[model samples]
Target: MKDSIGEKQVKVVIMKKFLIFIFTVFGLFVGWIAFMVYSYERSYNEWKSSYTGKIVTNSEKQFSSSSSSTQNYDYKKYSSSSDGNKDDLESLMNMFMKRLFPPTLLDPDYTYAYEKAKSWSKKHLSQQQIIIYLTKYDRYSEDATQYALNKLNVDWKEQALLRAKSYQEFHYSKNKLVEQLINIDKFTQEEADYAIEHVHFDWKENAVKEAESSSNGGNISKERLLKILVEYRKFTQEEAEYAIEHAKIDWLN
Candidate 1:
């Protein structure tokens, strides 16, 4: 009986050891599978993050390029429109001045109007167009005062005389009229006489001197001088003759 009991106890111990070994092997297999799954998940998350970053960066660069192109296009359009408007304003103003004045009176304000017209023409119209308009209606807009003084040719003499006559009609100083007459050899004796009659006391002596110096011996025609003098409501006939006689000649004349 003692031997049988001892054999049974040894069998029990062997069975316990086999069961423990099987459980240990199963535990190790489970641990290896869990580790493999965790490593794979971590690698997948890293790849997804890298792909997302690339997509975001590409989108931002495209947006920047599109915005820059739009701004350039807008700037060019705005510049072209502004230039066109300025040209239009100039053309309109030029047309308005021509309609307001008659040809004979155009010279007085021509210089001021012409400058404004020129600025407009350069910015808005072609050179050919500007030349054509000026040629067609230039007589009416001619700057008379500037033309008379600057042209200084035989052709300009008539216009200067007319301007002097106009000044006289308005009762401008006789001294002013005399200065203009002295330069004009073509001035009739009547015009000179008229100038003499209106001559201020302060200017009479100077006039006589200027007339004497003239090649004509200051003897401008008496009849012509009388006509101009009569127009001077302020002067008597005797006063006009006395002034003419007293006038002295300059050496240059």
Candidate 2:
């Protein structure tokens, strides 16, 4: 009877060990399945985000293409009126062109638009008109119109230059044309001098204050500021000298 009782106890112990091992295996299998499910969910979310970005990019491209197509059509319609009065036609053309070639289209990638404007100028505009249009359009082709302005012996050249300078003065840096003049390697020293002499720098105190607060102020060098002033046509020889003197004393340190 003692031997039988001992054997029964041994069997009970074996059964309990087997049950614990089965439960442990089951828990591990469940954990592995949960990990796989989480990984799949993460992968799916990433793919969705990528697809969404692609869709947005495509939509923006489509919108730009559509806008360009519409503008081309409008140009044709407005330009086709042969019986239209010259002043009326010019006014209409100017308004339409402004809409067609906004400032955003001035990037190098939009060389096609620049070519189109150049072609239009040659076909339909007088020299003065071409200068006006190109300057207004921000399609200033130095190789093309600037050369023509030099050759034309027209009083309008000064007018065109002044207009271009004025536009650049207002639109380019925050009155940093003097700095730009110094930095640009493209212009000859004589040309830079001419531009500096003619550049309009009706300096406003507010503008100077704004520049002081700008991100460019702390890092901007005296030479660069002088160049910008020259480019902007704002600095007289005396003012330029004074600025140099002041910058050396106040800013260089």
Candidate 3:
């Protein structure tokens, strides 16, 4: 009976030691996880601080200075460089953390921002226009919008021509067209000039059309139409004179 009692006490002591060992290991594991989380969060914050808030300029020349550098963060570069042995705890943790929380998630609306930007591009919107609408009206994050802008393959000259063509239905002189293209459409002078050079327009014909329209189907006199064309519509005196001669209007009326 005494031997049985001694064996029972030894078993109880061994069970207590085993329990203590298990608790110690569990506590260390919890501490390690906490430290890893804190490290990841701190690193992420530092990276974010350095990667955001770049400016996008309207000028092509200034693009490198104030542009989508922030949006162009190379995650692949980081991932590839950080690719160490799988047994490396720091490397494994970084990989795991990056996968668990991608940098794009920093802006909750990144998906919406890029998608909307693409839609705007398909509609033949200017880069400036897309940037403004995304950041100003839609309130998308600048980084995401800039990223979307950079991804787009756009021909600004072609866009300028398309925009210029849209003005054909209106009575705009070449000077007026250039002014509208540069000032309103945010196209560069070079682009606007290229557009004007390429677009199919007969300024004299447009002047005649304007003269007739100004006559309001012969409602106004030729002299009044001449004044409207040359003064208001910015047509040259020669063009306006041609328009007055060719347009179907009755000076007697």
Candidate 4:
């Protein structure tokens, strides 16, 4: 009986020691976690304070105190090495600064819209075209898209001219090209007229090329080709007649 009693006491003592060890280890782990969190927060706070203070000091220096008038400072100081226009560089800097430091901030939506619009502008798309694409296709908010559009310094006339020139390979008529620029590309009527005036192409030759392409199947009648050119391809009746005369096709076959 004495031996059994001593064995029970030994088991109890072993369990107590195990429990104490587990509790001690758990306490230490919790203390380590707390220390890590405290360290990260302290580091972040210090960096943020220092960086923000530096930015403010620089910003104050950038704005002259005497006249209190905003002068166009050389944007090169804030600009990255990338080759972009002055406005684009300024927008980029704005986004970068906003991302790095949080203050009176621009919406993320606006920033994204601005970048998207900038990309479309590089593709020679008109502002109206981009706005339509943003609102209709991308489902961006109109306010955000319009805000982005307002910031851009795009030459709509030049964009229209570039877009018009791109269709030269397709052989479009002047009237048809104007319709395309206005209806399809969303360029203003004035811009479309400017493009048509600037873009050089022979409408009659385009009609001929289009008629020739249509007759490549060798099964289409001349009347069909003429109709297709005039009605479907937007070529004038005279131009279509000229195409039917010039294009080589076996009308009987």
Instruction: Give the candidate number with the greatest lDDT.
Output: 4
TM value for model 1: 0.24
Model 3: lDDT to the true structure: 0.77
For model 1, the local distance difference test gives: 0.49
Is 1 or 2 the stronger prediction by TM-score?
A: 2
For each candidate, what is the lDDT? 0.49, 0.51, 0.77, 0.79
TM-score of each: 0.24, 0.26, 0.58, 0.54
- In model 3, the worst 10-residue window by lDDT is 51-60
Model 2: residue 56 alpha-carbon error in angstroms? 1.1
Per-residue accuracy of model 1 over 1-253 as CA lDDT, tens digit each: 9999999999999999999999999999898777656655554455457557856986686567656577786786578778755654454443333334453364444554455445534343322333344545554243443332233223223433444554533443354465545543334446555545643334444333333433255445655454454354223455456555565422232
- What digit string (tens of lDDT, one per residue) describes model 3 on residues 1-253? 9999999999999999999999999999999888778777776565445333221222334444544664443553356445533324454455446445654664457677878988887666677888899999998877778767766768888988988898899968888899898888788889999999998799999998888777766767777888888888889999999999899876647
Number of the candidate with higher TM-score, 3 or 4: 3
Clashing residue pairs, backbone N/CA/C < 3 A, model 3: none
Query: How would you encode candidate 4's per-residue C-alpha lDDT over 1-253 as one tens digit per residue?
Result: 9999999999999999999999999999999778666655665565557657867996797664444333424455546325434544465455445445432255678778888999998888888889888999988898789878877778899999999999999888788899899888889999999999888788898988888788874678887788889888889999999998987776746
After superposing candidate 1 on the true structure, give the runs of residues whose Cα lies further than 4 Å from its correct spot. Answer: 61-253
Candidate 1 at 233: error in angstroms? 99
lDDT of 4 at 228: 89
Which ranges in model 3 have alpha carbons more than 4 Å from their true place? 1-108
Q: After superposition, how far is residue 98 of candidate 3 from its true place, in Å?
A: 9.5
- By TM-score, the best candidate is 3
